[model samples]
Target chain A: MTALEYIRCIGESWPTTKERAYFEALALKEHGRLSPEHVPEVYHFDRTMSLIAMRYLEPPHIILRKGLIAGIEYPLLAQDMAEYMAKTLFFTSLLFRSTTEHKRDVAEFCGNVALIKHTGQVVFSDPYRVSQYNHWTSPYLDQDAEAVRKDNLLKLEVAELKSKFYERAQALIHADLHTGSVMVTPESTQVIDPEFAFYGPMGFDVGAFLGNLILAFFAQDGHADQVNDRKTYKEWILKTIEETWNLFHSKFIALWDEHRNGSGEAYLPEIYNNADVQLLLQKKYMTDLFHDALGFGAAKMIRRIVGVAHVEDLESITDVSKRATCERRALDLAKMLLKERRKFQGIAEIVAVIRQF
Target chain B: MTALEYIRCIGESWPTTKERAYFEALALKEHGRLSPEHVPEVYHFDRTMSLIAMRYLEPPHIILRKGLIAGIEYPLLAQDMAEYMAKTLFFTSLLFRSTTEHKRDVAEFCGNVALIKHTGQVVFSDPYRVSQYNHWTSPYLDQDAEAVRKDNLLKLEVAELKSKFYERAQALIHADLHTGSVMVTPESTQVIDPEFAFYGPMGFDVGAFLGNLILAFFAQDGHADQVNDRKTYKEWILKTIEETWNLFHSKFIALWDEHRNGSGEAYLPEIYNNADVQLLLQKKYMTDLFHDALGFGAAKMIRRIVGVAHVEDLESITDVSKRATCERRALDLAKMLLKERRKFQGIAEIVAVIRQF
Candidate 1:
């Protein structure tokens, strides 16, 4: 069954009447499957509450965060990720053969994904925002909290300035498909937590995935004990970034070529048909998105270290000097990412430098 | 004689009629000595051209760049620069004890400083509209014309941004007062180049001075050949930056206390009475400006080496790799400056780090 139908089943399984009502409403609103013609079968239990049920599909998957912490490598993982991102973001949003109404429905659904509010606040904010989390935090980590706050403020301001950037409604995006939210295998990847999903910058998804991988790679220094393993682990991280970017670009272009529909034709011309112009546009968009990604990634990395939830990197490094060294390197890389993101042309270039670290 | 009158004398001595007319108009507009009451003199210049001039006090001085390059340290140089900048930028703009008419006249005169225009196939446009000085050309220098073109272009862009920033009428600024422009001795410092001056961000001048000094410090690797003298020379450079920042802050606060006069009361109410608040405001401004300065300095340093005119610093390093190392260090420091500028509260912090390098 489709992802939405599976979510409906989970909602129906909730134990209480209030829970049933809340889930049903949430499933409809959050899933954007509210059309009368498309509504799933509604079941009633003891006449107390109504629920929706549907078949669920399970596929080979692994938690991205677990893989990161464990330093596991799956061949073509970066390539697969880039492809997945390119399809979900660039192809689905920019090249989808969908009607305007269909696209709008997707956007509206993604907007109501309250799971983001729940998870983002819980996982992201609790550790950083509360007083309890402030004490006994890493000293190096604490130094970055004010910076994180300032960065957040800046992003909010940028978001305000570029409000129109998200106005062109498009397909549903798996917004929070970073390491924690994505389940991956060799052949297929399943993205969970559609709550943070939204129609936004296509590059945002691409960046989030690749950025997380980079973060994981950098954090290895905190976890790995062997110097030799550290080198190999870091190599894997750089490789992931490079391959991911390459695969994403290739797949994005292919999808655009294969699915050029007439929708939004008046505003955005057929980008695929004109190779020179298309390449130029793609490079420009990618470059700008990369800069944004770098800034956001720095914010993410810094916040995780100091804001609320500290990473395992520093925790694993028992030696204060080593921990400080790793922290400094991570921060140095983050700062470099933010400042020099524009100067980089492709992910390979950036990954190459990161590898040197 | 006042600075304007001295400049007028220099203008009148120019061999070319075009140059003479330019300076003559400059003197009239800049020096309030030629008043609205002297309608005939003003009208004569008005008919001839639109450029304005002003008269101001002159003092014994020498360019800071020459001193830096030559490794000469005049006593009280740092204190002198701080006083000149603090008095000219903060006092004249915010705490001036002058009448409204006099302030207005000065403001108008500042507003009229000429902008350099890009004419024809010239790649680098002059934005300051200052008459080119044949005497100012470096005989010892061998500059790449194309590189110079590129550097000029970059400088032009910077100058344009600076002018636009000034047009907001934010504060009184000595728009152009680099080492070449400012004349100084142990007892006093005098700013020349009112030709390109305007009201703008006060920090721009601070950044220019400090940034240039930092560049010189880095450049000293080549300038002072002896290992021991190198240490001494580098120490001087570091001390200069530290003292310059310290004196500027101390004198700035002192001036703010003496004559703040309710001008910046809106954003800085407590600043009128609270020394701590004033210090914090100054610190924040300095921090932000330092970042910009580093970025600009990096760009300037890099362009000088790779693009057009090379610094004597690299010239002193005969080995290619060594020179590259120095260049690389400058670039690295530039990036570091951009990245960590916000973290620095005092010049000692910067000097400590530079000394480590």
Candidate 2:
């Protein structure tokens, strides 16, 4: 007999809870057509009870965030994540899918507006302004939080990204792609809990993963003890960030090239047939995407520092002052990335900036 | 009984024909929420028979194109069109409505894919490539047509615009808003025939109107006789183009200000409450929108000249060579506008270019 993992809403089941259940089930059910290896198989979904039963990872599969906190390295983490993001983002985009099929899904996924609005508030809005739900390391970061509200340039850039999140339906994205959403066992990686899935900018997903990894990297200072200085671990995280984006870019381009003659409606094969024009288009597309990923990734990093929901990486540091130091670094880097993201040409440049910090 | 105008599918009523009837009726039905004066009331719609009945404009309100071709100037044409475009586009956008409401309609309008695809082929695709449906003034425009296909920069710009049209669901736009789709007199303007309506880019409608007017301007020489040189009429057309865009810009801004505290989800009032920030955001928004309008208008003009659908303004010129000359001029202007639209800061600059042509 097969074992099934059931996710049930135990407490008061709000409309949003039920909605997420339905959407998550639909996402898993539809995963077979895309990259199915990293996604769990849906067995049964009971909408009324807000319950979902799916394949269980079992055994050594642990949440990626917990593993990061424990100083564990997954050698295949970057490659696996790159494969997952490239497949999910590229295949669902107009470059690989027909407009008709894409729009239908876009409309359907817009039902995840509950979570989208929540994200719009907590991630993009609340962190930048005074909100009842917002908090940090209290006095240690009080000035930093206030400075965020007063920064006009940061506000302007964030407004641009927020509007893009609301408007651009580039692909079906796994909306909440933080490390906590992934389960890994060195050789295996599984992305779970796609309750927030929707057709949004592909960079949102790419940025989420990269941004969380950066957060994990910053928190390593607080985690360091006598045994491990965490210097090598930090390098590994930066390397992973660089490799994931580089690999995703190449893989996405490869898919575009392979499917140039397919039903993808964005660039007709007849128009973009020549080598020079293809290179130009690819360069522009990837450049814009790279900038977007950096901007959104930075935004994600900022939210974790001061927003309502935060990661365990920084929270685990018993000393509040030390945790605040790590958070302040992440927050400063995020603000800079959000503002000066367009100035960055590649992931290596981003890595260099991180090293400087 | 009130006079009724019934639009019926003529022959071979395909699924697309029935789809158009349903969407057109929905467009007209929804027009009441935005601008009422410029739109005829929808009386009845039959999906099965592909028929629509609506209020009819009186005889004085001749089709705008016919009036333009005959050298008759409607003073209110620009004002009425500006009002129509601003109200319809603003009210239907996330700037004025919640994201949930907006996405529902966006999904519903995805059913208008048939016309959208047809538009993709004719306006954005077929004009720049070889298709059996493509035919210009032939011998006269053979080089011009060939030139369009050969111009790498023009093709690159068009592909960008095409992808935007396919992707950006900014607002509910009148997908076929050429002068022919409008009826007008010296005192009044009434927009009709929204069979191609969908939740697409607002600039598409604005561009379609301006592009057609530009076409009419280019065709005046062919229509010139001893009685009317059309020099003053030409100036009026250019003035109207300038007025329409400027008025739309101001009206759109006014609406945004009035509803700044409303339910618009795109720019939250709480975030953009300050005057400096508000001014900055509006500048960026309006600037991007202006460039989009210009690009889309240029594409519309080029398609009419070289694609499947030829405008009556250019077609009615009895002298074949004369008509060819007019088309060639319009084609040249459109190619320039498409390639260099970003360099233009104001509608007046665009008017200056139109005059130079």
| Top candidate when judged by TM-score against the true structure | 2
Candidate 1 lDDT (Cα, 0 to 1) = 0.49
Q: Can you list each candidate's DockQ? A: 0.01, 0.60
lDDT of each: 0.49, 0.87
List where candidate 1 sits over 4 angstroms from the true fold: A1-61, A97-99, A110-136, A147-171, A186-188, A226-228, A261-274, A310-325, B1-357
Give lDDT tens digits, candidate 1, residues A254-304. 766555455522113421234554555456555655665555555455445
Which candidate should be chosen as best, given lDDT against the real structure? 2
Q: Judge candidate 2 at residue A45 and give its lDDT.
A: 84
lDDT of 2 by residue, A50-105 (tens): 77777888768999999999999999999889988888888888898887888788
- Model 2 lDDT, full chain set: 0.87
Off by over 4 Å in 2: A1-12, B1-14
